[model samples]
Target chain A: DAGVTQSPTHLIKTRGQQVTLRCSPKSGHDTVSWYQQALGQGPQFIFQYYEEEERQRGNFPDRFSGHQFPNYSSELNVNALLLGDSALYLCASRLVGASTYNEQFFGPGTRLTVL
Target chain B: SQQGEEDPQALSIQEGENATMNCSYKTSINNLQWYRQNSGRGLVHLILIRSNEREKHSGRLRVTLDTSKKSSSLLITASRAADTASYFCATGGTGKLIFGQGTTLQVKP
Candidate 1:
Protein backbone atom coordinates (compact mmCIF):
# COMPACT_ATOMS: atom_id res chain seq x y z
CA ASP A 1 0.00 0.00 0.00
CA ALA A 2 2.99 2.26 -0.16
CA GLY A 3 2.80 5.23 -2.47
CA VAL A 4 5.55 6.30 -4.87
CA THR A 5 8.97 6.80 -3.31
CA GLN A 6 12.11 8.68 -4.46
CA SER A 7 15.66 8.77 -3.21
CA PRO A 8 18.26 11.44 -2.60
CA THR A 9 15.76 13.99 -1.35
CA HIS A 10 18.36 16.62 -2.21
CA LEU A 11 21.38 16.67 -4.51
CA ILE A 12 24.15 19.11 -5.31
CA LYS A 13 26.07 19.01 -8.58
CA THR A 14 28.12 21.30 -10.74
CA ARG A 15 27.81 22.11 -14.41
CA GLY A 16 29.01 19.33 -16.74
CA GLN A 17 28.47 16.73 -14.04
CA GLN A 18 26.00 13.90 -14.20
CA VAL A 19 23.36 12.97 -11.64
CA THR A 20 20.99 10.09 -11.26
CA LEU A 21 17.71 10.11 -9.31
CA ARG A 22 15.83 6.96 -8.44
CA CYS A 23 12.16 6.23 -7.94
CA SER A 24 10.16 3.22 -6.83
CA PRO A 25 6.65 3.15 -8.09
CA LYS A 26 3.68 2.31 -5.96
CA SER A 27 2.82 -1.32 -5.54
CA GLY A 28 0.92 -2.94 -8.41
CA HIS A 29 2.06 -0.21 -10.80
CA ASP A 30 4.18 -0.85 -13.86
CA THR A 31 4.55 2.49 -15.60
CA VAL A 32 6.83 5.29 -14.51
CA SER A 33 7.05 8.87 -15.73
CA TRP A 34 9.52 11.62 -14.91
CA TYR A 35 9.00 15.36 -14.79
CA GLN A 36 11.05 18.47 -14.10
CA GLN A 37 9.60 21.52 -12.38
CA ALA A 38 11.55 24.72 -12.36
CA LEU A 39 10.91 27.47 -9.86
CA GLY A 40 7.56 29.18 -10.30
CA GLN A 41 6.58 26.83 -13.13
CA GLY A 42 4.63 23.68 -13.60
CA PRO A 43 6.24 20.35 -14.21
CA GLN A 44 7.43 19.63 -17.74
CA PHE A 45 7.20 16.08 -18.91
CA ILE A 46 10.55 14.38 -19.31
CA PHE A 47 9.77 10.82 -20.38
CA GLN A 48 7.62 7.81 -19.60
CA TYR A 49 8.67 4.18 -19.26
CA TYR A 50 6.56 1.06 -19.44
CA GLU A 51 7.39 -2.58 -19.79
CA GLU A 52 11.06 -1.65 -19.44
CA GLU A 53 10.88 0.44 -22.59
CA GLU A 54 10.47 4.12 -23.12
CA ARG A 55 6.96 4.57 -24.41
CA GLN A 56 6.93 8.35 -24.80
CA ARG A 57 9.12 11.39 -24.40
CA GLY A 58 8.66 15.13 -24.20
CA ASN A 59 10.65 18.09 -25.59
CA PHE A 60 13.67 17.43 -23.46
CA PRO A 61 17.14 17.11 -24.97
CA ASP A 62 19.32 14.02 -25.30
CA ARG A 63 21.09 14.87 -22.10
CA PHE A 64 18.00 13.77 -20.20
CA SER A 65 17.60 10.02 -20.20
CA GLY A 66 15.74 7.46 -18.13
CA HIS A 67 15.50 3.73 -17.51
CA GLN A 68 12.79 1.46 -16.22
CA PHE A 69 13.89 -1.60 -14.34
CA PRO A 70 12.13 -4.96 -14.40
CA ASN A 71 10.63 -4.25 -10.99
CA TYR A 72 9.00 -1.12 -12.35
CA SER A 73 11.38 1.20 -10.59
CA SER A 74 12.81 4.11 -12.59
CA GLU A 75 15.91 6.25 -12.78
CA LEU A 76 16.30 9.64 -14.36
CA ASN A 77 19.79 10.55 -15.50
CA VAL A 78 20.84 14.02 -16.49
CA ASN A 79 24.18 14.42 -18.22
CA ALA A 80 26.37 17.46 -18.52
CA LEU A 81 23.94 19.34 -16.40
CA LEU A 82 23.68 23.11 -16.46
CA LEU A 83 22.76 25.61 -13.83
CA GLY A 84 19.34 25.83 -15.39
CA ASP A 85 18.90 22.16 -14.61
CA SER A 86 18.45 23.02 -11.00
CA ALA A 87 14.88 22.10 -10.23
CA LEU A 88 12.64 19.62 -8.48
CA TYR A 89 12.63 16.27 -10.26
CA LEU A 90 9.35 14.45 -9.80
CA CYS A 91 8.41 10.81 -10.41
CA ALA A 92 4.91 9.58 -11.02
CA SER A 93 3.61 6.08 -11.64
CA ARG A 94 0.42 4.40 -12.71
CA LEU A 95 -0.79 1.00 -13.72
CA VAL A 96 -0.96 1.03 -17.48
CA GLY A 97 -4.22 -0.15 -18.98
CA ALA A 98 -5.93 0.25 -15.66
CA SER A 99 -9.66 0.78 -15.80
CA THR A 100 -9.24 4.16 -14.16
CA TYR A 101 -8.49 7.28 -16.17
CA ASN A 102 -4.73 6.91 -15.99
CA GLU A 103 -4.50 8.68 -12.67
CA GLN A 104 -0.85 8.89 -11.61
CA PHE A 105 0.54 8.76 -8.08
CA PHE A 106 3.48 11.03 -7.46
CA GLY A 107 6.40 10.83 -5.09
CA PRO A 108 8.07 13.50 -3.05
CA GLY A 109 10.42 15.08 -5.60
CA THR A 110 14.14 15.14 -5.46
CA ARG A 111 15.50 18.67 -5.25
CA LEU A 112 18.46 19.04 -7.64
CA THR A 113 20.75 22.00 -7.45
CA VAL A 114 23.22 22.39 -10.29
CA LEU A 115 25.82 25.02 -9.60
CA SER B 1 6.28 23.62 -24.08
CA GLN B 2 3.41 23.49 -21.59
CA GLN B 3 0.02 22.69 -23.04
CA GLY B 4 -2.16 24.30 -20.35
CA GLU B 5 -2.12 27.75 -18.78
CA GLU B 6 -3.75 28.73 -15.50
CA ASP B 7 -5.34 32.08 -14.89
CA PRO B 8 -4.72 34.56 -12.08
CA GLN B 9 -1.26 33.12 -11.46
CA ALA B 10 -1.88 33.88 -7.77
CA LEU B 11 -4.99 34.15 -5.62
CA SER B 12 -5.52 35.01 -1.99
CA ILE B 13 -8.74 34.55 -0.05
CA GLN B 14 -9.77 34.28 3.55
CA GLU B 15 -10.89 31.06 5.19
CA GLY B 16 -14.52 30.07 4.60
CA GLU B 17 -14.28 31.70 1.19
CA ASN B 18 -14.28 29.86 -2.10
CA ALA B 19 -11.30 29.64 -4.43
CA THR B 20 -11.59 29.08 -8.13
CA MET B 21 -8.79 28.36 -10.59
CA ASN B 22 -9.12 28.12 -14.34
CA CYS B 23 -7.01 26.29 -16.86
CA SER B 24 -6.93 26.50 -20.62
CA TYR B 25 -5.20 23.99 -22.85
CA LYS B 26 -4.06 24.10 -26.44
CA THR B 27 -4.77 20.53 -27.57
CA SER B 28 -7.33 17.82 -27.24
CA ILE B 29 -7.06 15.47 -24.30
CA ASN B 30 -8.64 12.29 -23.10
CA ASN B 31 -8.82 13.45 -19.50
CA LEU B 32 -7.99 16.51 -17.47
CA GLN B 33 -6.62 16.21 -13.95
CA TRP B 34 -6.03 18.71 -11.18
CA TYR B 35 -3.22 18.30 -8.69
CA ARG B 36 -2.22 20.16 -5.56
CA GLN B 37 1.37 20.77 -4.57
CA ASN B 38 2.50 22.24 -1.30
CA SER B 39 5.72 24.19 -1.38
CA GLY B 40 7.26 22.57 -4.47
CA ARG B 41 6.71 19.04 -3.20
CA GLY B 42 4.95 16.07 -4.68
CA LEU B 43 1.69 16.72 -6.43
CA VAL B 44 -1.44 15.30 -4.84
CA HIS B 45 -4.15 14.26 -7.24
CA LEU B 46 -7.30 16.24 -6.70
CA ILE B 47 -9.69 15.11 -9.37
CA LEU B 48 -9.81 13.82 -12.94
CA ILE B 49 -12.56 14.64 -15.35
CA ARG B 50 -12.89 12.64 -18.53
CA SER B 51 -13.31 14.29 -21.89
CA ASN B 52 -16.91 13.18 -22.03
CA GLU B 53 -17.77 14.43 -18.59
CA ARG B 54 -18.84 17.99 -17.98
CA GLU B 55 -18.59 18.38 -14.23
CA LYS B 56 -17.38 16.26 -11.33
CA HIS B 57 -17.19 16.71 -7.61
CA SER B 58 -15.03 15.30 -4.84
CA GLY B 59 -15.56 16.43 -1.28
CA ARG B 60 -15.49 20.21 -1.33
CA LEU B 61 -13.87 20.28 -4.77
CA ARG B 62 -15.88 20.79 -7.91
CA VAL B 63 -14.35 20.52 -11.36
CA THR B 64 -15.95 21.67 -14.55
CA LEU B 65 -14.58 20.89 -17.98
CA ASP B 66 -15.65 22.68 -21.13
CA THR B 67 -14.27 20.63 -23.98
CA SER B 68 -15.47 23.01 -26.64
CA LYS B 69 -13.62 25.84 -25.01
CA LYS B 70 -10.62 23.66 -24.11
CA SER B 71 -10.78 24.91 -20.61
CA SER B 72 -11.29 23.54 -17.09
CA SER B 73 -11.98 25.13 -13.76
CA LEU B 74 -11.53 23.88 -10.22
CA LEU B 75 -13.65 25.26 -7.41
CA ILE B 76 -12.63 24.73 -3.81
CA THR B 77 -15.48 25.59 -1.52
CA ALA B 78 -15.31 26.90 2.02
CA SER B 79 -11.56 26.87 1.83
CA ARG B 80 -9.39 26.42 4.86
CA ALA B 81 -5.85 27.50 5.52
CA ALA B 82 -4.78 23.93 4.79
CA ASP B 83 -6.09 24.47 1.26
CA THR B 84 -3.20 26.80 0.55
CA ALA B 85 -1.15 25.29 -2.25
CA SER B 86 -0.27 25.54 -5.90
CA TYR B 87 -2.89 24.03 -8.14
CA PHE B 88 -1.93 22.59 -11.49
CA CYS B 89 -4.01 21.24 -14.31
CA ALA B 90 -2.62 18.49 -16.50
CA THR B 91 -4.00 17.26 -19.78
CA GLY B 92 -3.71 13.60 -20.57
CA GLY B 93 -3.36 12.38 -24.13
CA THR B 94 -1.20 9.75 -25.72
CA GLY B 95 -0.36 8.49 -22.24
CA LYS B 96 1.73 11.50 -21.38
CA LEU B 97 0.66 14.43 -19.29
CA ILE B 98 1.20 18.06 -20.27
CA PHE B 99 1.03 20.37 -17.26
CA GLY B 100 0.14 24.02 -16.89
CA GLN B 101 1.92 26.64 -14.90
CA GLY B 102 0.13 26.27 -11.58
CA THR B 103 -2.12 28.76 -9.82
CA THR B 104 -0.93 29.59 -6.35
CA LEU B 105 -3.82 29.74 -3.91
CA GLN B 106 -3.48 31.12 -0.42
CA VAL B 107 -6.38 30.61 1.94
CA LYS B 108 -5.81 32.83 4.92
CA PRO B 109 -6.99 31.87 8.37
Candidate 2:
Protein backbone atom coordinates (compact mmCIF):
# COMPACT_ATOMS: atom_id res chain seq x y z
CA ASP A 1 0.00 0.00 0.00
CA ALA A 2 1.12 3.56 -0.64
CA GLY A 3 2.06 5.81 2.25
CA VAL A 4 0.92 9.37 2.81
CA THR A 5 1.42 11.56 -0.26
CA GLN A 6 1.71 15.35 -0.69
CA SER A 7 1.41 17.44 -3.79
CA PRO A 8 3.64 20.11 -5.42
CA THR A 9 6.87 18.82 -3.90
CA HIS A 10 8.08 22.43 -3.77
CA LEU A 11 6.31 25.77 -4.02
CA ILE A 12 7.41 29.41 -4.16
CA LYS A 13 5.24 32.31 -3.02
CA THR A 14 5.70 35.95 -2.13
CA ARG A 15 4.58 38.04 0.78
CA GLY A 16 0.83 38.78 0.97
CA GLN A 17 0.13 35.87 -1.37
CA GLN A 18 -1.73 32.70 -0.49
CA VAL A 19 -0.87 29.04 -1.03
CA THR A 20 -2.58 25.71 -0.57
CA LEU A 21 -0.82 22.39 -0.08
CA ARG A 22 -2.55 19.06 -0.54
CA CYS A 23 -2.18 15.74 1.21
CA SER A 24 -3.46 12.19 0.54
CA PRO A 25 -3.36 10.10 3.62
CA LYS A 26 -2.11 6.56 3.81
CA SER A 27 -4.44 3.75 2.85
CA GLY A 28 -7.01 2.85 5.50
CA HIS A 29 -6.28 6.00 7.52
CA ASP A 30 -8.93 8.54 8.40
CA THR A 31 -7.17 11.23 10.45
CA VAL A 32 -4.81 13.80 8.94
CA SER A 33 -2.62 16.42 10.58
CA TRP A 34 -0.42 19.19 9.25
CA TYR A 35 2.91 20.41 10.57
CA GLN A 36 5.38 23.16 9.71
CA GLN A 37 9.07 22.44 10.02
CA ALA A 38 11.32 25.45 9.87
CA LEU A 39 15.00 25.24 9.10
CA GLY A 40 17.04 23.65 11.85
CA GLN A 41 13.98 22.97 13.98
CA GLY A 42 11.46 20.25 14.62
CA PRO A 43 7.99 20.34 13.16
CA GLN A 44 5.32 22.51 14.77
CA PHE A 45 1.83 21.09 14.70
CA ILE A 46 -0.63 23.17 12.72
CA PHE A 47 -3.87 21.27 13.14
CA GLN A 48 -5.54 17.88 12.89
CA TYR A 49 -8.66 16.89 10.99
CA TYR A 50 -11.03 14.01 11.50
CA GLU A 51 -14.31 13.15 9.86
CA GLU A 52 -14.24 16.35 7.82
CA GLU A 53 -13.93 18.44 10.96
CA GLU A 54 -11.06 19.93 12.88
CA ARG A 55 -10.42 17.91 16.00
CA GLN A 56 -7.41 19.73 17.43
CA ARG A 57 -5.22 22.73 16.69
CA GLY A 58 -1.90 24.13 17.71
CA ASN A 59 -0.80 27.70 18.54
CA PHE A 60 -0.83 28.79 14.90
CA PRO A 61 -2.75 31.92 13.99
CA ASP A 62 -6.00 32.18 12.11
CA ARG A 63 -4.09 32.65 8.85
CA PHE A 64 -3.30 28.95 8.90
CA SER A 65 -6.30 26.82 8.17
CA GLY A 66 -7.02 23.31 6.89
CA HIS A 67 -9.81 21.11 5.61
CA GLN A 68 -10.43 17.38 5.40
CA PHE A 69 -12.43 15.92 2.57
CA PRO A 70 -14.78 12.99 2.88
CA ASN A 71 -12.12 10.75 1.34
CA TYR A 72 -9.76 11.59 4.21
CA SER A 73 -7.48 13.78 2.09
CA SER A 74 -6.50 17.17 3.49
CA GLU A 75 -5.38 20.62 2.37
CA LEU A 76 -3.43 23.22 4.30
CA ASN A 77 -3.89 26.85 3.37
CA VAL A 78 -1.67 29.68 4.51
CA ASN A 79 -2.85 33.20 3.81
CA ALA A 80 -0.78 36.39 3.70
CA LEU A 81 2.41 34.41 3.72
CA LEU A 82 5.48 36.00 5.21
CA LEU A 83 9.15 35.28 4.62
CA GLY A 84 9.15 33.34 7.85
CA ASP A 85 6.48 31.10 6.35
CA SER A 86 9.15 29.42 4.29
CA ALA A 87 9.46 25.91 5.62
CA LEU A 88 8.69 22.24 4.96
CA TYR A 89 5.00 21.50 5.17
CA LEU A 90 4.50 17.97 6.41
CA CYS A 91 1.37 15.84 6.38
CA ALA A 92 0.78 12.97 8.76
CA SER A 93 -1.97 10.36 8.92
CA ARG A 94 -3.27 7.88 11.45
CA LEU A 95 -6.35 5.80 12.09
CA VAL A 96 -8.56 7.38 14.72
CA GLY A 97 -9.92 3.99 15.70
CA ALA A 98 -6.61 2.13 15.65
CA SER A 99 -5.83 2.62 19.29
CA THR A 100 -5.42 5.18 22.02
CA TYR A 101 -1.70 5.31 21.27
CA ASN A 102 -1.68 6.89 17.87
CA GLU A 103 1.29 6.28 15.58
CA GLN A 104 1.41 8.80 12.79
CA PHE A 105 2.91 8.10 9.38
CA PHE A 106 4.22 11.12 7.49
CA GLY A 107 4.48 12.12 3.88
CA PRO A 108 7.48 13.46 1.94
CA GLY A 109 6.25 17.03 2.65
CA THR A 110 5.91 20.12 0.49
CA ARG A 111 8.71 22.65 0.71
CA LEU A 112 7.28 26.17 0.81
CA THR A 113 9.48 29.16 0.06
CA VAL A 114 8.11 32.61 0.85
CA LEU A 115 9.90 35.59 -0.57
CA SER B 1 4.47 25.29 24.54
CA GLN B 2 4.30 21.70 25.72
CA GLN B 3 7.09 20.81 23.33
CA GLY B 4 9.89 18.59 24.54
CA GLU B 5 13.50 19.80 24.41
CA GLU B 6 16.35 17.57 23.34
CA ASP B 7 19.86 17.84 24.81
CA PRO B 8 23.21 18.08 22.98
CA GLN B 9 21.59 19.87 20.09
CA ALA B 10 24.14 18.18 17.84
CA LEU B 11 26.30 15.07 17.97
CA SER B 12 28.91 13.50 15.68
CA ILE B 13 30.35 10.03 16.00
CA GLN B 14 32.12 7.45 13.92
CA GLU B 15 30.28 4.60 12.29
CA GLY B 16 29.93 1.44 14.37
CA GLU B 17 29.69 3.54 17.51
CA ASN B 18 26.54 3.96 19.48
CA ALA B 19 24.54 7.18 19.60
CA THR B 20 22.26 8.37 22.38
CA MET B 21 19.85 11.29 22.48
CA ASN B 22 17.80 12.56 25.38
CA CYS B 23 14.54 14.48 25.54
CA SER B 24 12.69 16.25 28.35
CA TYR B 25 9.17 17.62 28.22
CA LYS B 26 7.22 20.06 30.40
CA THR B 27 3.80 18.42 30.86
CA SER B 28 2.16 15.09 31.33
CA ILE B 29 1.52 13.11 28.17
CA ASN B 30 -0.39 10.06 27.07
CA ASN B 31 2.57 8.92 24.99
CA LEU B 32 6.01 10.00 23.81
CA GLN B 33 7.24 9.29 20.30
CA TRP B 34 10.58 9.53 18.52
CA TYR B 35 11.07 10.39 14.88
CA ARG B 36 13.95 10.74 12.43
CA GLN B 37 14.16 13.13 9.52
CA ASN B 38 16.72 13.18 6.81
CA SER B 39 18.03 16.51 5.58
CA GLY B 40 15.21 18.43 3.91
CA ARG B 41 12.73 15.58 4.36
CA GLY B 42 9.74 14.68 6.46
CA LEU B 43 9.85 12.88 9.75
CA VAL B 44 9.65 9.07 10.04
CA HIS B 45 8.24 7.63 13.23
CA LEU B 46 10.84 5.66 15.13
CA ILE B 47 9.14 4.54 18.32
CA LEU B 48 6.38 5.33 20.77
CA ILE B 49 6.30 4.82 24.52
CA ARG B 50 3.15 5.18 26.55
CA SER B 51 2.95 6.96 29.89
CA ASN B 52 2.92 3.76 31.89
CA GLU B 53 5.79 2.19 29.99
CA ARG B 54 9.41 2.61 31.00
CA GLU B 55 11.42 0.87 28.30
CA LYS B 56 10.95 -0.48 24.80
CA HIS B 57 13.30 -1.96 22.25
CA SER B 58 13.02 -2.38 18.51
CA GLY B 59 15.89 -3.84 16.57
CA ARG B 60 18.92 -1.59 17.12
CA LEU B 61 16.84 1.06 18.83
CA ARG B 62 16.28 1.16 22.58
CA VAL B 63 13.89 3.69 24.07
CA THR B 64 13.52 4.38 27.77
CA LEU B 65 10.90 6.61 29.30
CA ASP B 66 10.84 8.04 32.81
CA THR B 67 7.48 9.73 33.13
CA SER B 68 8.23 10.81 36.68
CA LYS B 69 11.12 12.87 35.30
CA LYS B 70 9.36 13.74 32.06
CA SER B 71 12.37 12.49 30.15
CA SER B 72 13.15 9.89 27.49
CA SER B 73 16.23 8.58 25.76
CA LEU B 74 16.81 6.89 22.41
CA LEU B 75 19.84 4.69 21.87
CA ILE B 76 20.97 3.45 18.46
CA THR B 77 23.59 0.71 18.47
CA ALA B 78 26.09 -0.12 15.73
CA SER B 79 25.30 3.07 14.01
CA ARG B 80 25.89 3.55 10.32
CA ALA B 81 26.36 6.59 8.13
CA ALA B 82 22.78 6.18 7.01
CA ASP B 83 21.78 6.78 10.61
CA THR B 84 22.85 10.41 10.31
CA ALA B 85 19.78 12.57 10.67
CA SER B 86 17.82 14.83 12.99
CA TYR B 87 15.92 13.07 15.76
CA PHE B 88 12.94 14.61 17.47
CA CYS B 89 10.87 13.71 20.53
CA ALA B 90 7.17 14.45 20.58
CA THR B 91 4.73 14.26 23.46
CA GLY B 92 1.13 13.31 22.66
CA GLY B 93 -1.81 14.42 24.73
CA THR B 94 -5.51 14.89 24.03
CA GLY B 95 -5.02 14.26 20.30
CA LYS B 96 -2.19 16.79 19.95
CA LEU B 97 1.46 15.99 19.53
CA ILE B 98 4.01 18.63 20.57
CA PHE B 99 7.52 18.21 19.24
CA GLY B 100 10.92 19.00 20.70
CA GLN B 101 13.65 21.13 19.16
CA GLY B 102 15.38 17.96 17.84
CA THR B 103 18.94 16.59 17.97
CA THR B 104 21.08 16.42 14.87
CA LEU B 105 23.19 13.27 14.68
CA GLN B 106 25.99 12.72 12.21
CA VAL B 107 27.55 9.30 11.95
CA LYS B 108 30.74 9.39 9.91
CA PRO B 109 31.97 6.37 8.06
User: Each candidate's DockQ score against the native complex?
Assistant: 0.79, 0.68
Q: What C-alpha lDDT, on a 0 to 100 scale, does residue A30 get in candidate 2?
A: 95
Top lDDT model: 1
Off by over 4 Å in 1: none
Q: Which ranges in model 2 have alpha carbons more than 4 Å from their true place?
A: none
| Per-residue alpha-carbon lDDT of candidate 1 for residues B9-99, written as tens digits (9 for 90 to 100) | 9999999999999999998888999999999999999999999999999999999999999999999999999999999999876557889
Deviation (Å) of A49 in candidate 2: 0.9
Candidate 1 backbone collisions, by pair: none
In candidate 2, the second chain superimposes onto the true chain B with a TM-score of: 0.95
lDDT of 2 by residue, B1-109 (tens): 6376898899999999999999999887888999999986878999998888999999999999998898999999999999999999998764567899999999999
Model 2 interface DockQ: 0.68
What is the C-alpha lDDT profile of model 1 across A1-115, one tens digit per residue? 9999999999999999999999999999999999999999999989999999999999999999999999999999999999999999999999877866778899999999998
Residue B98 in model 1: lDDT: 84
